[model samples]
Target: MKTRIKKMSDDLLWIFYPTLCAACDRPLLMGEECLCTFCKYYLPRTHFHLQSINPVAKHFWGKVPIQAATSYYYFSKGEKVQRLIHKLKYKDRKDVGMYIGQLMGSDMKDSPFPKPDIVVPVPLHEKKLKLRGYNQSDFIAEGFAKSMNAVFEPQMVYRNKETETQTRKHRFDRYMNMDNVFSINKELAASDKNILLIDDVITTGSTLISCAEALLEIPGTKLSIASIACA
Candidate 1:
């Protein structure tokens, strides 16, 4: 009875506020669609998935030796992609992250990149996780795992220290501060696995590089990366 009541309540809420696209705020029709048709076709894709040395990979050229890297879309400031990401991170729209992840996963399904054995999302500090009630990267990983037919290991990595936000920090400062912020959970390590590290966005690639650095500590682990957007 409780489950049924909860389902009915959710149904009523959806009726009161219809499902809308994250990109354009238009009502979405039934069947697995997230973005409106206009937004779907018009949104700028990075096409990095099809290239070996794309801009996303170039960001980490000298910093880390990632096996592969790609971003689903190019992020232009003050555009729909930026707005969608803001809502996903700040406004608690986790669905937006998952929706974008699913879209990217579908695109990557046919790409030339090698398949990954597991997906690992960049972890949030315990305090931040408690405050937000969820990790946005975990949601993105869940969507990617479903579409890519790979395992999603939410606890494979963890943030050991809480660092300041990297919003206004210079690139070098970000790299320095983020270096020791992440550590791998030794209990969850799987030997010789190809791990696909996931995050919401890639700016200087500092955060992802930090996480990858920790993951690399584990012997025989290969690392790749994916993100919703690249700035």
Candidate 2:
């Protein structure tokens, strides 16, 4: 009876204010959550986790030692993936992060990727966190932790300084801006544990580099990175 009542309520709600897909903006069916089935099936998957020398992994070469790194989707200008990211970051859509993380988890489940003992998100600056009311990466980390059977440490590492925006900045400028911006708690990262550092996206990867540098200092901690997309 509860299920039937819910079905009726969903139908009525759809009639009054139908749901729409986050990526495609199509009207969602009653059972669809966050995105329509079609979007879920067709959203681009990078499959970088399946390979040994994926682009994401190579991006860190000579910079930081990482066991592996890959994004679930390829981000491009004027694309549905871009739209999804915009919603996740700027539009207060935490569900978009969780959905993408869950999709990403499916790839990690049986892949060559290293299993993580603790999942840590790239920390948001206190000012940015105040403006946004939540860290988008934490939402993604939560979903990934749920699927990967790992502990989620939302505050293990944090932004020590607020850096200037990376937008339209040169790679060197981005690097300088992010340098020493992140600091980690040594005791929390733990020794002899594999730590997966997660974020919403990777561009020049300066931000991740700063965070990884701090995380790697933890004795016996192995580091890997994952993101929702790579531009």
Task: Return the top candidate by TM-score.
Answer: 2
For candidate 2, write residues 122-212 as lDDT tens digits.
Answer: 9999999999888999989988988898999998898999988899899989989888888877557688899999998899999999999
Cα miss at 77, model 2 (Å)?
A: 0.9
Give all candidates' CA lDDT scores.
0.87, 0.89
Candidate 1 on 81-191: residue-level lDDT in tens?
Answer: 988888888788988877787888888889886578899899999999999888999889988988899999999899899999999999999999897888888899998
Model 1: how large is the Cα RMSD against the reference?
Answer: 3.3
- TM-score of every candidate relative to the true structure: 0.90, 0.96
Compared with the true structure, the alpha-carbon lDDT of candidate 1 equals: 0.87
What candidate 1 gets wrong by more than 4 Å, as runs, is 1-16
CA-only RMSD, every prediction = 3.3, 1.3
Native-to-model Cα distance after best TM-score fit, residue 189 in candidate 1, in Å? 0.4
Task: Tell me the lDDT of candidate 2.
Answer: 0.89
